[model samples]
Target chain A: MKRALRLRPKGLEKGRPETKPTNDAERRQLMTAEGEVRGELRRLRARLPQVTGALAASADGLVLASETDEAKEAEHVAALTAAALGVALRLTEATGQGGFRELLIRGESGYVATYAAGPTAVLTLLAEPRINVGRLHLEARRSGARIGELIRGALERPALVPRKPNRPPSLAGP
Target chain B: MANTETALKEATTAIEGAVGAALVDYTSGMALGTIGGGKDLDLNVAAAGNTDVVRAKVRTMELLGMQDEIEDILITLGTQYHLIRLLKGRNHSGLFLYLALDKQRANLAMARHQLKRIEADLEV
Candidate 1:
């Protein structure tokens, strides 16, 4: 029973790479996976020069993958982004707005935009002034839908921890 | 707003000295659109500046651990009233439509009701 409630399976193997694709096959697989889902962020980048980075993160703020050096800080960004997402989600529910779609952040140097990627993940982008923001937004929205499909696929997998059978009660115990 | 154009136009005309009427997103400080911003009042600057107001208010609510949502935020100037209404619809989260009206000509009750109507129709 304790095992069933645990978040992840206990460790038995350790040789696998911690992150990212390491070879051509894996890279090709990832690209194909995204492409299959119609995740075409590359085209968006071509149209928007200021959109320097794009990434997808889990609802818990775990960085899935990103195009920038900020991958190392993805967790932190994800967490804060999740907080904002939570607020946005709730606001939509409370107001009868239909559904929460996206979030936007603007600063002097750049803009950070996030969109809902299915139920369990988010797609985020960092854009500067050089790009056509409107075009970037259009592309990002399409990519967000594809990312949502990817996330949904990941979420459909069985839980890592297995459940245990119920134990019979002991007569002697008080 | 379900009838943003009508409400905005009415607000501007009815109020004796309304400088502007705008629907702004507090999170990004972007005006979805605006009406009545004159040379003296820049709606863009107002939108950006008001982001700080929304942020500070939200931060304060967090510090106090308040679970209630902000219904409306009123900023009172000597001659002006800056009214911020947080949208309730799922379509417009992290956004509040703001209206600036002159203190003398505007009726607060009518303004609030009209603003609510406008919020209902805003496309976001």
Candidate 2:
């Protein structure tokens, strides 16, 4: 199965933290256009009673958008999730595990469900204690396909317009 | 209660002293639906803990190069029994239903039999 996220060499230059998209000039761009993505994810979250929040993060730990108040911290979680995915994918491949599907982390307070949106993005759903597991999977699975399409579109070309003010290209450069 | 709700309720009621019955995503250790998880026993922890069980078994299978899927996993404790049933459906992958039962009050065989039936009729 094709994975939603890919692992690059450790030494590869990573992109800078995403600039907040604000102005119409930057908002018009596709790659950095987070409004639509965030809206869709928000809608998806609404459908899943178990999902307290949802976010789409790049495999490299860039937070695209999130519905939770802690959207900013999504970057941190994404980075660790990316690392785990890298290890899990490699292990699956080395031993001939059929395909990489989904990744999950459970904590004392809640559950984190990660579904591969494509080779570049992961859709994470955070659920409270009452969240239904079966329903979440069904819901996240649907959103994953949609999010995959959106992310894949964005990745087709790097968003040319910069969202941050007068930022040097070096920020995006490796 | 609706039809689905009725089914779930009936299933839980059939098992004497059923602590919790959840439809869990083994791939992500998320419990889809849970009934009867009290403050003392957190279903979320149970779901995540069983994830390790599923992963260990899958990894062991890989090491042995065995390609068959796991049907179910049964963990027997002194006072309770944890049953993990992998839901096998075209749309259902990396998912399972976890049921915890009081050992003294539960009939293991009956619980397993009923779970299989519930799994078959599960919508997702």
Candidate 3:
């Protein structure tokens, strides 16, 4: 994480010495912002023993931070969440329910709950079937809101630093 | 819900491995009377999601130019079978019945048969 963050500034600092230090500082800030989001996920897991995994993903299906066992599973889950969200949004609109806030899907063995983390991100949780759903919603909703704020804060903080336009066709894990 | 609530109830209790059932307005993505969702799902919300499932397939079939009436749409997940039966007749127009089942214990063919029976016996 640090290497990539540091490398961006060096690559851009061929002649632009005026903005180099501040950009480096901004990258450091971004890394810490990501760390804070991870910390929130960790704390959420501590609170809910039934929570097997937690992931934050952009609305467009990019993995922001994954607390799952496998990186590939996290990426797949994030992408699937984006696809599912599209349908859920349409369903809500068709029913005149306004925007979607959350979606909870339960398979035969377990549960996959997704909370809308603001407008641009989603927080997904994998939990055991036996978990208390009311409590899961109570806790996940709070964490989802916090992660949203933290992420949005990071994005806004680097206001001058325009986001890289070259997003990968597939996920480039953050 | 008033007339066929019993029918929806029977789907869960009578059908082996039945998880849930709902009568949906696929046109509006609204659930009529949802019951017995697998694990902890809100059957109403799942029903709405399934509306898109039905729509997407119908649209795909149209794209492929397969001109046939849809009878049943089956979605097989790792551990569950989602059986959707599109209702015929005038009163049941633009509607579909959704049945979710546990894959392990479910007799898929029998479930389909029983669901067809429920559909035939459906009042509204």
Candidate 4:
């Protein structure tokens, strides 16, 4: 019999924290951009008949937005995407295949696909088995590019504040 | 129902010119079971490496807005054919079967047919 091993790599759940905006203006701008991203995801789902779920996550596995009803499943899928992305990036680099593009996995019942939305985020979709592959790619690519821009723009905003360092207690004199 | 290991071994024996076969979890990039790999072809490494291929294709499909199920992924080389068959069924999600065959002795069509049968019978 084939051995089934359940393995979870170290630090797989350690997603990078989003940058904190320095002031109210920056925070408002970031919020607006995030709202736009969510709207785009919703439209993508609405336009695609076979798409059962859609999620946007950071490269480190943090879930930013999800259209699925199952929040837990979305979280798990995001983490898995991050892990798979690591391997995909390395494979492309080692084989001189240029940059990572996308990934698709098909099963008897449905399909799961991951797209590199931008330099820092990934977009994943779940769809039915009978969905049209060509259409899925066409719409997803356009939406992914748009999402990438929104996310990258938010990340590049100059109003982010550096995290404060912890201070040790003074022991020299009381 | 046949187990994954039995199914893997059966695949190697039933398919002509098969050098190695493995059951891999693309989510974790780990091989659940393997048979018939040596110095020239390491089943573990192949299984892990192929996870990336499966992932890349899935990503491409999403980006292109193509909604379709992948039946199998075939990679052809000078002397070898790498076949990746994604598993279906509720219990078999997130898994795939990887088969490597010597191009000279294997019939691609027949091999794919046999692998499909094995995949159907495989019990996760």
**Candidate with best lDDT:** 4
The better candidate by DockQ, 1 or 3, is 1
lDDT of 1 at A90: 60
TM-score of chain A of each: 0.62, 0.70, 0.74, 0.73
Supply fnat for every model shown: 0.00, 0.11, 0.00, 0.00
Global lDDT of each candidate: 0.63, 0.68, 0.75, 0.77
lDDT of 4 by residue, A1-174 (tens): 111111122243246222211344533434446677888899999988679999887666767788887999999999998788778766765786765668889988999998877655678999997665655766787788888788657655554455433211111111
- Model 2, chain B: what is the TM-score? 0.89
| TM-scores, all models, native as reference | 0.41, 0.47, 0.46, 0.45
Candidate 2, residues B54-113: lDDT per residue as tens digits?
Answer: 877988999999989898999999999989888787887877778888999999989999
In candidate 3, stretches whose alpha carbon ends up further than 4 angstroms from where it belongs are A1-32, A159-174, B1-124
Instruction: Please report, as a residue range, the 10-residue window in candidate 3 chain A with the lowest summed lDDT.
Output: A1-10
Model 3 C-alpha lDDT per residue in residues A1-174, reported as the tens digit of each score: 011001122255466441122234444444456678889989999987879999987666767788899999999999899888767766766786765678999888789999877655779999997565655777788898888788657755644545553221211122
Please give, for residues A29-121, the per-residue lDDT of candidate 1 as tens digits.
Answer: 333344434234555566555678776765555556666556566556777876776677667657866455778887888888988766555
- Highest TM-score, which number? 2
- Pick by TM-score: 1 or 4, better one: 4
Cα error of candidate 4 at position A4, Å: 34
Task: Give residue A120's error in model 4 in angstroms.
Answer: 1.0
Q: Which model, 2 or 3, shows the larger DockQ?
A: 2
Whichever of 2 and 3 has more lDDT, that candidate is 3
